[model samples]
Target: MAATEQEESLDDLPPSAKLVFKVLEYNGPLTQKGIAEETMLSARTVRYALERLEGISLVTEDVYFADARQNLYQLTEPAEEFTASDGEEATCAD
Candidate 1:
Protein backbone atom coordinates (compact mmCIF):
# COMPACT_ATOMS: atom_id res chain seq x y z
CA MET A 1 0.00 0.00 0.00
CA ALA A 2 1.04 3.58 -0.56
CA ALA A 3 2.22 5.75 2.30
CA THR A 4 -0.84 7.94 2.16
CA GLU A 5 -3.11 4.92 2.21
CA GLN A 6 -1.37 3.47 5.22
CA GLU A 7 -1.57 6.83 7.02
CA GLU A 8 -5.27 6.98 6.28
CA SER A 9 -5.65 3.53 7.74
CA LEU A 10 -3.89 4.72 10.92
CA ASP A 11 -6.57 7.37 11.23
CA ASP A 12 -9.19 4.67 11.61
CA LEU A 13 -7.48 3.08 14.62
CA PRO A 14 -8.74 3.62 18.16
CA PRO A 15 -7.39 6.54 20.17
CA SER A 16 -5.59 4.21 22.56
CA ALA A 17 -3.86 2.50 19.69
CA LYS A 18 -2.90 5.82 18.16
CA LEU A 19 -1.46 7.00 21.45
CA VAL A 20 0.52 3.79 21.75
CA PHE A 21 1.89 4.28 18.27
CA LYS A 22 2.97 7.83 19.07
CA VAL A 23 4.69 6.67 22.22
CA LEU A 24 6.69 4.10 20.32
CA GLU A 25 7.49 6.57 17.60
CA TYR A 26 9.03 9.02 20.04
CA ASN A 27 10.57 6.71 22.63
CA GLY A 28 11.97 4.04 20.37
CA PRO A 29 11.47 0.36 21.23
CA LEU A 30 9.95 -0.46 24.60
CA THR A 31 8.61 -3.46 26.46
CA GLN A 32 4.95 -3.75 27.43
CA LYS A 33 5.65 -2.63 30.98
CA GLY A 34 7.49 0.42 29.74
CA ILE A 35 4.65 1.31 27.40
CA ALA A 36 2.10 0.93 30.16
CA GLU A 37 4.11 3.14 32.49
CA GLU A 38 4.82 5.76 29.88
CA THR A 39 1.25 5.98 28.76
CA MET A 40 -0.24 5.39 32.22
CA LEU A 41 -2.53 2.94 30.50
CA SER A 42 -3.50 -0.40 31.96
CA ALA A 43 -1.55 -3.46 30.94
CA ARG A 44 -4.61 -4.91 29.20
CA THR A 45 -5.13 -1.64 27.32
CA VAL A 46 -1.50 -1.51 26.25
CA ARG A 47 -1.64 -5.10 25.11
CA TYR A 48 -4.79 -4.44 23.11
CA ALA A 49 -3.28 -1.37 21.52
CA LEU A 50 -0.14 -3.28 20.63
CA GLU A 51 -2.23 -6.02 19.07
CA ARG A 52 -4.11 -3.52 16.94
CA LEU A 53 -0.90 -1.77 15.85
CA GLU A 54 0.68 -5.12 15.04
CA GLY A 55 -2.37 -6.19 13.07
CA ILE A 56 -2.06 -3.16 10.81
CA SER A 57 1.68 -3.80 10.22
CA LEU A 58 2.61 -0.51 11.87
CA VAL A 59 4.45 -2.03 14.82
CA THR A 60 6.98 -4.86 15.02
CA GLU A 61 7.73 -7.00 18.05
CA ASP A 62 11.00 -8.65 18.88
CA VAL A 63 12.52 -10.47 21.82
CA TYR A 64 13.78 -8.13 24.52
CA PHE A 65 17.41 -9.07 25.08
CA ALA A 66 17.55 -7.38 28.47
CA ASP A 67 14.62 -9.42 29.73
CA ALA A 68 13.89 -12.67 27.96
CA ARG A 69 10.36 -12.81 29.28
CA GLN A 70 9.32 -9.57 27.62
CA ASN A 71 9.09 -8.42 24.02
CA LEU A 72 10.08 -5.05 22.58
CA TYR A 73 7.78 -3.06 20.34
CA GLN A 74 8.77 -0.39 17.78
CA LEU A 75 7.57 1.13 14.59
CA THR A 76 8.13 -0.89 11.44
CA GLU A 77 10.45 0.56 8.76
CA PRO A 78 7.63 1.91 6.64
CA ALA A 79 5.88 3.26 9.67
CA GLU A 80 9.06 5.01 10.73
CA GLU A 81 9.21 6.81 7.42
CA PHE A 82 5.66 7.97 7.89
CA THR A 83 6.82 10.08 10.81
CA ALA A 84 10.46 10.74 9.95
CA SER A 85 9.80 12.10 6.50
CA ASP A 86 7.08 14.31 7.78
CA GLY A 87 9.21 15.54 10.69
CA GLU A 88 6.17 15.72 12.95
CA GLU A 89 4.45 13.58 15.48
CA ALA A 90 1.11 12.13 14.49
CA THR A 91 -1.67 13.58 16.57
CA CYS A 92 -3.80 11.26 18.65
CA ALA A 93 -7.18 12.75 19.47
CA ASP A 94 -8.70 10.84 22.31
Candidate 2:
Protein backbone atom coordinates (compact mmCIF):
# COMPACT_ATOMS: atom_id res chain seq x y z
CA MET A 1 0.00 0.00 0.00
CA ALA A 2 1.11 3.57 -0.70
CA ALA A 3 1.11 6.51 1.69
CA THR A 4 -1.56 9.19 1.59
CA GLU A 5 -1.08 12.70 0.23
CA GLN A 6 -1.91 14.29 3.56
CA GLU A 7 0.70 16.78 4.77
CA GLU A 8 1.99 17.56 8.22
CA SER A 9 1.48 20.95 9.85
CA LEU A 10 4.03 23.04 11.77
CA ASP A 11 2.48 21.87 15.01
CA ASP A 12 3.45 18.32 14.12
CA LEU A 13 7.17 19.11 14.16
CA PRO A 14 9.42 18.83 17.18
CA PRO A 15 10.17 21.77 19.44
CA SER A 16 13.70 22.19 18.13
CA ALA A 17 12.43 22.20 14.56
CA LYS A 18 9.82 24.75 15.48
CA LEU A 19 12.48 27.00 17.00
CA VAL A 20 14.59 26.69 13.90
CA PHE A 21 11.57 27.59 11.75
CA LYS A 22 10.84 30.64 13.90
CA VAL A 23 14.45 31.75 13.84
CA LEU A 24 14.50 31.62 10.08
CA GLU A 25 11.12 33.25 9.84
CA TYR A 26 12.34 36.23 11.85
CA ASN A 27 15.99 36.48 10.82
CA GLY A 28 15.66 35.59 7.17
CA PRO A 29 18.29 33.41 5.44
CA LEU A 30 21.11 32.00 7.50
CA THR A 31 23.71 29.26 7.31
CA GLN A 32 23.59 26.04 9.29
CA LYS A 33 26.21 27.41 11.67
CA GLY A 34 24.31 30.65 12.01
CA ILE A 35 21.07 28.84 12.75
CA ALA A 36 22.80 26.65 15.30
CA GLU A 37 24.23 29.68 17.01
CA GLU A 38 20.99 31.63 16.89
CA THR A 39 18.93 28.72 18.15
CA MET A 40 21.63 27.74 20.65
CA LEU A 41 21.36 24.15 19.46
CA SER A 42 24.14 21.74 18.70
CA ALA A 43 25.26 21.35 15.13
CA ARG A 44 24.00 17.77 15.05
CA THR A 45 20.62 18.85 16.38
CA VAL A 46 20.33 21.74 13.94
CA ARG A 47 21.20 19.40 11.12
CA TYR A 48 18.50 17.01 12.22
CA ALA A 49 15.89 19.76 12.51
CA LEU A 50 16.91 21.11 9.12
CA GLU A 51 16.52 17.67 7.62
CA ARG A 52 13.02 17.39 9.05
CA LEU A 53 12.06 20.85 7.81
CA GLU A 54 13.45 19.99 4.39
CA GLY A 55 11.52 16.73 4.32
CA ILE A 56 8.35 18.73 4.97
CA SER A 57 9.22 21.39 2.35
CA LEU A 58 9.03 24.16 4.92
CA VAL A 59 12.49 25.67 4.59
CA THR A 60 14.56 25.98 1.47
CA GLU A 61 18.29 25.39 1.08
CA ASP A 62 20.40 27.55 -1.15
CA VAL A 63 24.07 27.91 -1.90
CA TYR A 64 25.73 30.74 -0.02
CA PHE A 65 27.25 33.17 -2.48
CA ALA A 66 29.71 34.54 0.05
CA ASP A 67 30.82 31.07 1.03
CA ALA A 68 30.27 28.06 -1.16
CA ARG A 69 31.22 25.78 1.73
CA GLN A 70 27.95 26.63 3.47
CA ASN A 71 24.31 26.61 2.48
CA LEU A 72 21.79 29.32 3.42
CA TYR A 73 18.42 28.52 4.91
CA GLN A 74 15.24 30.56 4.53
CA LEU A 75 11.47 30.20 4.59
CA THR A 76 9.55 29.51 1.37
CA GLU A 77 7.48 32.63 2.02
CA PRO A 78 6.74 35.28 4.61
CA ALA A 79 5.25 34.06 7.83
CA GLU A 80 1.49 34.50 8.22
CA GLU A 81 1.54 37.99 9.71
CA PHE A 82 -0.95 40.66 8.80
CA THR A 83 -2.33 43.66 10.59
CA ALA A 84 -5.73 45.20 9.96
CA SER A 85 -6.69 48.83 10.53
CA ASP A 86 -9.15 49.73 13.31
CA GLY A 87 -9.14 46.12 14.50
CA GLU A 88 -10.88 45.00 11.33
CA GLU A 89 -10.61 41.33 10.43
CA ALA A 90 -8.45 40.83 7.42
CA THR A 91 -9.46 38.60 4.53
CA CYS A 92 -7.29 36.62 2.19
CA ALA A 93 -8.40 38.73 -0.75
CA ASP A 94 -7.68 42.02 0.96
Candidate 3:
Protein backbone atom coordinates (compact mmCIF):
# COMPACT_ATOMS: atom_id res chain seq x y z
CA MET A 1 0.00 0.00 0.00
CA ALA A 2 1.03 3.58 -0.54
CA ALA A 3 2.29 5.66 2.37
CA THR A 4 -0.55 8.13 2.14
CA GLU A 5 -3.12 5.36 2.22
CA GLN A 6 -1.48 3.73 5.19
CA GLU A 7 -1.33 7.02 7.00
CA GLU A 8 -4.97 7.66 6.34
CA SER A 9 -5.85 4.36 7.96
CA LEU A 10 -4.13 5.44 11.14
CA ASP A 11 -5.98 8.75 11.17
CA ASP A 12 -8.93 7.09 12.82
CA LEU A 13 -6.99 6.16 15.93
CA PRO A 14 -7.25 8.22 19.12
CA PRO A 15 -4.35 10.37 20.25
CA SER A 16 -3.27 7.94 22.96
CA ALA A 17 -3.22 5.04 20.55
CA LYS A 18 -1.25 7.09 18.03
CA LEU A 19 1.17 8.07 20.76
CA VAL A 20 1.74 4.43 21.67
CA PHE A 21 2.31 3.62 18.02
CA LYS A 22 4.86 6.43 17.73
CA VAL A 23 6.75 5.30 20.83
CA LEU A 24 6.97 1.76 19.54
CA GLU A 25 7.85 2.96 16.07
CA TYR A 26 10.90 4.81 17.32
CA ASN A 27 12.07 2.75 20.28
CA GLY A 28 11.48 -0.81 19.14
CA PRO A 29 9.62 -3.23 21.39
CA LEU A 30 8.62 -1.98 24.83
CA THR A 31 6.71 -3.18 27.84
CA GLN A 32 3.57 -1.35 28.90
CA LYS A 33 5.41 0.51 31.64
CA GLY A 34 8.05 1.59 29.13
CA ILE A 35 5.40 2.94 26.84
CA ALA A 36 3.72 4.74 29.70
CA GLU A 37 6.98 6.32 30.74
CA GLU A 38 7.93 7.36 27.23
CA THR A 39 4.53 8.73 26.36
CA MET A 40 3.88 10.16 29.79
CA LEU A 41 0.65 8.27 29.80
CA SER A 42 -0.62 6.35 32.78
CA ALA A 43 0.12 2.63 32.75
CA ARG A 44 -3.57 1.89 32.67
CA THR A 45 -4.03 4.27 29.76
CA VAL A 46 -1.14 2.74 27.86
CA ARG A 47 -2.48 -0.74 28.43
CA TYR A 48 -5.91 0.37 27.28
CA ALA A 49 -4.51 1.87 24.11
CA LEU A 50 -2.37 -1.18 23.51
CA GLU A 51 -5.37 -3.41 23.90
CA ARG A 52 -7.29 -1.33 21.38
CA LEU A 53 -4.39 -1.40 18.95
CA GLU A 54 -4.01 -5.14 19.46
CA GLY A 55 -7.67 -5.68 18.67
CA ILE A 56 -7.18 -3.86 15.38
CA SER A 57 -4.02 -5.88 14.64
CA LEU A 58 -1.89 -2.73 14.73
CA VAL A 59 0.22 -3.92 17.67
CA THR A 60 1.36 -7.28 18.94
CA GLU A 61 2.02 -8.53 22.47
CA ASP A 62 4.62 -11.17 23.14
CA VAL A 63 5.29 -12.82 26.44
CA TYR A 64 9.02 -12.68 27.02
CA PHE A 65 9.04 -14.85 30.14
CA ALA A 66 6.30 -17.03 31.53
CA ASP A 67 6.79 -15.65 35.02
CA ALA A 68 6.66 -12.03 33.90
CA ARG A 69 3.32 -10.31 34.27
CA GLN A 70 3.83 -7.88 31.43
CA ASN A 71 4.44 -8.53 27.76
CA LEU A 72 6.48 -6.58 25.25
CA TYR A 73 4.64 -4.82 22.45
CA GLN A 74 5.75 -4.38 18.85
CA LEU A 75 4.02 -2.68 15.97
CA THR A 76 2.34 -4.89 13.45
CA GLU A 77 2.78 -4.62 9.69
CA PRO A 78 0.01 -2.13 9.12
CA ALA A 79 1.43 0.10 11.83
CA GLU A 80 4.95 -0.09 10.41
CA GLU A 81 3.63 0.50 6.94
CA PHE A 82 2.22 3.81 8.03
CA THR A 83 4.66 4.88 10.75
CA ALA A 84 8.04 3.69 9.49
CA SER A 85 10.09 3.90 6.35
CA ASP A 86 12.56 1.13 5.54
CA GLY A 87 13.03 0.55 9.28
CA GLU A 88 13.84 4.22 9.82
CA GLU A 89 12.02 6.07 12.52
CA ALA A 90 8.79 8.03 11.97
CA THR A 91 6.83 10.31 14.23
CA CYS A 92 3.15 10.54 14.98
CA ALA A 93 1.56 13.88 15.74
CA ASP A 94 -1.41 14.61 17.98
Question: How does each model score on TM-score?
Answer: 0.75, 0.76, 0.68
lDDT for each residue of candidate 2 in 1-94, tens digit (9 for 90 to 100): 1232137767888999999999998999999999999999999999999988887778999999999999999987634456466677756874
Best-matching candidate per TM-score: 2
RMSD of each: 8.7, 6.0, 9.0
Give the alpha-carbon lDDT of every model.
0.89, 0.88, 0.83
Per-residue alpha-carbon lDDT of candidate 1 for residues 20-61, written as tens digits (9 for 90 to 100): 999999999999999999999999999999998987788999
**Backbone N/Cα/C clashes per model:** 0, 0, 0
Predicted candidate 3 versus true structure: per-residue lDDT over 18-93, tens digit per residue: 9999999999999988899999999888988887788667889999584388798998775554667677778777
Whole-model lDDT, model 2: 0.88
| Top lDDT model | 1
**Lowest summed lDDT over 10 consecutive residues: which window, candidate 1?**
78-87
Clashes of 2: 0
